[model samples]
Target: MNSNRVRAVLVAVTAVASVLGAPDQATAEPAARGGTQWKCGFYPTPGDPQGTTARYFHCAYNHIMIRVHWSNGASHLGCIEPWENHPFWRDGGNVVVNAYFVPVTPRVLIAPSGRRVCAASQPTG
Candidate 1:
């Protein structure tokens, strides 16, 4: 191959390799420390004309739902609901839902129940 053609091929290969070599470059780390985790309960707040309004209770076990926010600017929602007898909600009564925001790609973890949602800043395991 001509010297110029070879150089061009080398450059192309190097570019491709660089891209393949760093798949995580575009994504952030997951579950990094210093991130914020919220543990709250979802319950109907009294006095609402609607009778019940879901509110964050600052406790997990009693929470009807849980959400996580990661320091990496990511968040994840629990897959279990407090009313659904989820393994996470076994202790029910005044339960505090635990959630942490992870710094990773695909930053959201929605519960299978579709009632909970979480988001992350990066990809996580």
Candidate 2:
């Protein structure tokens, strides 16, 4: 998609995320083979990038929490890293991403770690 379209999509995703900000533990999905599936805010959006440290997207549930840090670069798919919590791996300009609550099911497996998405995100217009 083009930059403008990507921006619009990102905005829409974040907008939809308003209602998904904090999911209830009662809504946690059933665990499968120990681990369950997780999702993003609909569309990927950039988190905070400044100061001495970098902020990331994260949530807490089932006594487990995950954090998705914004990548300086872009990839095709979201990510298949050691952990899949990243929700914002898109390339946007000055995006102020809001926070959301995270929940977990159960698991004892390791995922890949590195660049999240394989689809490179161009600068949003």
Best by TM-score: 2
Q: Mind giving the per-residue lDDT tens digits that candidate 2 earns over 72-111? A: 3221212111222444433444332333333432222211
lDDT of 1 by residue, 1-125 (tens): 23243235434643453445423211222232136332234443445453332334232222222453323343344322222212222122332233432223233333333432223222223
Worst ten-residue run, lDDT, model 1? Answer: 83-92
Backbone clash numbers for all candidates listed: 38, 21
Error of 2 at 40 (Å): 16
Pick by lDDT: which candidate is best? 1
